[model samples]
Each structure stands twice: as C-alpha cells, then as structure tokens.
Target: MSRNASASTRIRVAAGAAVLITVACTASATALDRSAETRSPGTPREAAALTGSAKLYRPLGDDITFTFDAHLAAEHRMDPAKATGTFRFSHYLDGRGAWAEGRIDCLLTGGKVAVASGVITRTDLPGAQGNRVGFTVHDVGRHDRLGYSWASVGNPVETKDLPKCVSAAPFEKVKNGTGDFRVLPWDPDFLKEG
Candidate 1:
C-alpha cells in the first residue's frame, strides 16, 4: 500500500510541474505579442529603420551642390502615410550656402531606393520657409545617386505648391568619394546587384 501511495504522489508532483511550465510559457508568449502590437500598431512586426547622408555635387557646375542628412523610422501601421524622423538639407550655389532643418514627414522605400519629404521649420534658404521639400537616394555600392525636388520638379514659384515627397528619379551620380547614401533594407537579399 505504501509503494502505491508513493508512486501516486510522485505522479501528482510531475503533473503539477508540467502544468506550471505550460502556464509560464503561455504567459510569456502573450506578453511578447502585446509588446509587438504596441510597437508597430496593427502590424505583426516593425519595419526596419532608415538612415543616410550625402553631399552630392550637381553636374551642371562644380560649385552647385546639395547635401542631405536623414534618420527616418519605420512607418507605423496606424499612420501608413507618414514616417517620423529628422532631415536637414543644404544647397550650395556659387560658393553661397543655404540650409533648412525639418522633420521627415513622408518616406517611401523599395530595394535600394528611398524617397523622403520634409517641411522646413527653420531655414536660411529664401523661398523655402514653411514649404515641403523632397529628396531621393539610390544606394549603389560604388556609384550612388541623389536627387533634389527643387531641381527635379523644377523650382516652383511657390515652394508650398510642390507635392509632398515628390521627386524625379535619382539621375545625378555622386561626384566623388566624398558623397554616398545607404538604403538599408530589412532583408539583405532585397538589395539589387551593382
């Protein structure tokens, strides 16, 4: 009788341990799911972030240049139309420099290409105050490209009239080793061959 009781007690303890482990695992998984939902709202997971900078010289003249610095976060599913971050732009012409700093309002990316837009909050650039500007970056290994909406869309009489995040395809090559930009993809295989 004692042997049978001992066996029964051992069985109960083993069963109790198994139940406890299962409960712990389920609770952990539930917590993880809730965390992901909060981070990306309506998505199962967050998209990868983007960051890049460039100092591209225009082909029209050696003195003409456009510089860009950006840090853009993944678009939240709740606000699918926008990406949040900072973008600073600088234009140089005939040795004079004008710059604007703003928050990145829009971003679109595919493979190695990324286009972004921002509204100028502060600037020394005339005619750019309270206006949205666009930019494009193509991340090719040795021969990257960059484009400015002011040049691609043509300098509009009213900068505010320019469409948000609109820019022509990146056509100007980086002039030298001093210029480059990167479009980091979530998957390494998504980038195109150079």
Candidate 2:
C-alpha cells in the first residue's frame, strides 16, 4: 500500500509540472504574437519594412557632390493606388574616403507609375554639421507587373542642405502614405547563381 501511494504521488507531481510548463509556453507565445501584430501591415509601423539595394548620384550644391550605394531595410507600404515607406540607409560614399548613413520618408503615387517625395536626413558633407535634405523621386517603374519593385530618378529639393546637427530624425506628424512598390521575399539565391 505504501508503494502504491508513493507511485501515485510521483505521477501527480509529474503531471502538475507538465501542466505548468504548458501554461507558461502558451503565455509566452501570446506575448510574441501581440508584439508582431504591432508591426503588421497597415498598423502605422513606420510605413513599411523592406530589404533592398539602391544607388543614387546627385549634386547637393554647386561645389558638393553626393553619391552612394545604399543597402537598406526600410518600412514600406503598398496598395492598389499608392505606396510609401520610410528607410534608414547605410551609405558608402563615392571614393571620398568617407561614409554616411541617413533616413528618408518616401511616398509614391499612381501605383506602378508614380512620383515620390520625402524629407531626407544625412550626415553633413563639406561641413561637420548634419543636414536635412528634401528629395523627389519621379518616373517610378516597377520590375514586376503584378508587384511593387520599382526604380526612380530623383534630385534634391533644395540646392543646399539645411543645417540640422542631429544624428537621427523621426518622421514628424506623418502617419502613412500610399503608392506601389513590389517587395520580393528574401531567399538564398546567391548560392544558386554559380
């Protein structure tokens, strides 16, 4: 009888532990799901999130040249009529022995054929102070007809950068904007290219 009681107590203890573990796991999963939802589409999580490459070259002013190869993961949005996104880019400057990173809050209109505009912030060149530059991306063209992948040509909004000695700037009073740009899901394609 004692043996049987000992066996029963052991079983009960094990079962209770299992139940507690299950409850803890369920609670953890719920929390993760809620955090992900905050960044979901149309949730006002900095427009859109995307990973891609861009190359830009533009004369900032009469004496300053700004060019960069940008690898960026940005927040983006795409809909039937419009698309938009905000991006922070790691920029490699052109052969100047210098580097800079910056952010742009961009908008494009008219789906595949669109125009884009945004306020840009970048570390200062030709000066030690950072600056705010506005840009307009026009003649947007998408690579996929049914998708939002696109390229555009644009230029600075002003002939010179506005002196703003800050490292980063948050989008001010902007909720969301729309247009069309296709984002391809990431995959390991480089290994297959050989």
Best by TM-score: 1
Model 2, 123-152: lDDT tens per residue? 434442233443222223332111111112
Taking all chains together, each candidate's TM-score versus the true structure is 0.61, 0.31
Local distance difference test, per candidate? 0.66, 0.34
Q: How badly does each model clash, as a count of residue pairs? A: 0, 11
lDDT of 1 by residue, 60-105 (tens): 5644344444443344533424566777766576777677777777
Error of 1 at 100 (Å): 1.6
What C-alpha RMSD separates each model from the true structure?
10.7, 14.7
Clashes of 2: 11
Q: Model 2: what TM-score?
A: 0.31
Model 1 lDDT at residue 179: 54
